[model samples]
Target: MENRINNITYDDMKVFFINKVKELKSWPYNGKNVVIAPLPEHVTVNPDKPSMFCFTEINDDYMEFRRSAFWLVSGTVVMAFMISMMSIAYLAIAVCFFYDGSFESTLFLCFFGSFFGLYVLPMAARIAFFIPHDLPVRLNRKTQKVYIASLILHGNIFRLRPELIFQEMDWKYIEGWVLHRSVGKGTPYYGLHLVENKSGDINRLQQACLYRTGAPWSTSEMEYQINNIMSTWSYCQHFMNYLPVPDETEKDKNFVFLSNNWLFKWPEAMDKASRSSG
Candidate 1:
């Protein structure tokens, strides 16, 4: 039988994510606690969270793997071409040696064999790196607690398994979310990130993935931004019952503030800048 969740499209992604969120909310973990199972991180989760926030696992984004492979190949294009040319030259030499009944032909064959192993290694590593695009997040409205359960891939290929790991913290620990900004092709892009203080030190959590309502976009009215990264940030402020107090240590270079204006700024198009200035 065919899989229900494979070869997913953009619309399929929307539906799948919506259903997954619902499933997470309802599923009881081992009949004792409510928890989200492991999901491939990139398919979900906002980055800028702790780099190690989610356990990295191979997802099924073959296209992304292909893209990664393409870039890897491009970076080593010259070297790979040279290797191919040398392999061909060696093979020709080996053929001549074999025709003359020379033992050196076997040595040349061994050198030619090394090229295939080098090519296979990167492809295998890329395959291992691809992960399912699902977010492993569980929220319990009754308890108002959020749980993150990630599965680290372990063991050899013959007995590979997911070793489940998790962290739990109160919702109140969330300080806020931040809007990360950047520009591409003259259009502005924003990523929502989370900030939490559960660890005593205030630091940004992963990206505030608010795909439930819709992807984030800039809006003047905060009300419309609900369920979005920007609105989530506002909600966190509201939940704090006041603006978040800045940590003095946040001024340090190693610190990342949720509201770093410089990190969120994007260059405007020349005409837009000129018009604004005028």
Candidate 2:
């Protein structure tokens, strides 16, 4: 028997489409024509668009392991060398004291051991400091929408929140929503977290989300929710209108992902959202 549920009509599809459009009208990023979607599995986002979504995982596994090993070995060697040198020096000084009673030799050994342990040992430890590998978020700008994908190191797989970055950015130049994970069957909410920028500065302007099993929703579902939210709230209107004029070139170099102005400036858009919601 033909299944009634399987036989949806063209008119039904049209009605469904219209209803979806209506629901999007009240969401953030609604006014702008651009849409941001995650890259398909095995595909990646392009890198030319400023407002597109992208992601990268910072890999610290191998570097951390190697650093720990180097520190252990180097620390052991330094300790052993310092102890041996000090012991030998003290023995020689004792022998000299017994034979000719030379106070100068004993003082020299003491100073030598102190200098090597205090200064040289610390310098040796500095050699083990390794920078963690950075992940890149790739984006592609289409005529109306943006595509995004994440390029993370194989060993570093952890969830992240992108709204913090969005809060910091000059929303005037960004017209799309970064895909985010959602929670519950009701309308999905984006997860915003505070993250530190490359220069060790704390900024909350990034827009991206990572997958978390513990979260109430999956990554794909979150992206759909973000799209719905953007559609309803009209969040992209400002970005499409007032593009930011860069203040300084040197300051721009400080951030890992966002522009200097976006990272440093306080979040005005989020405040507006709060006021409107209230």
lDDT of 1 by residue, 15-41 (tens): 333343233321111122112222321
What candidate 1 gets wrong by more than 4 Å, as runs, is 1-130, 149-165, 181-189, 199-227, 231-278
Error of 2 at 216 (Å): 48
lDDT of 2 by residue, 1-278 (tens): 43221243333322333333233221221222322232221112221222212222112110000011111112322443455455556556655654444677667656765665465444332221211112112111112121122221111112111221222222223322233322235433342111112222112123322221112245685455344333322212222223321222222221221121222222465333322312
For candidate 2, the per-residue lDDT at 238 reads 20
Question: Relative to the unseen true structure, what is the Cα RMSD of model 1?
Answer: 20.1
TM-score of each model, in listed order: 0.31, 0.18
> Best by lDDT, which number?
1
lDDT of each: 0.31, 0.27
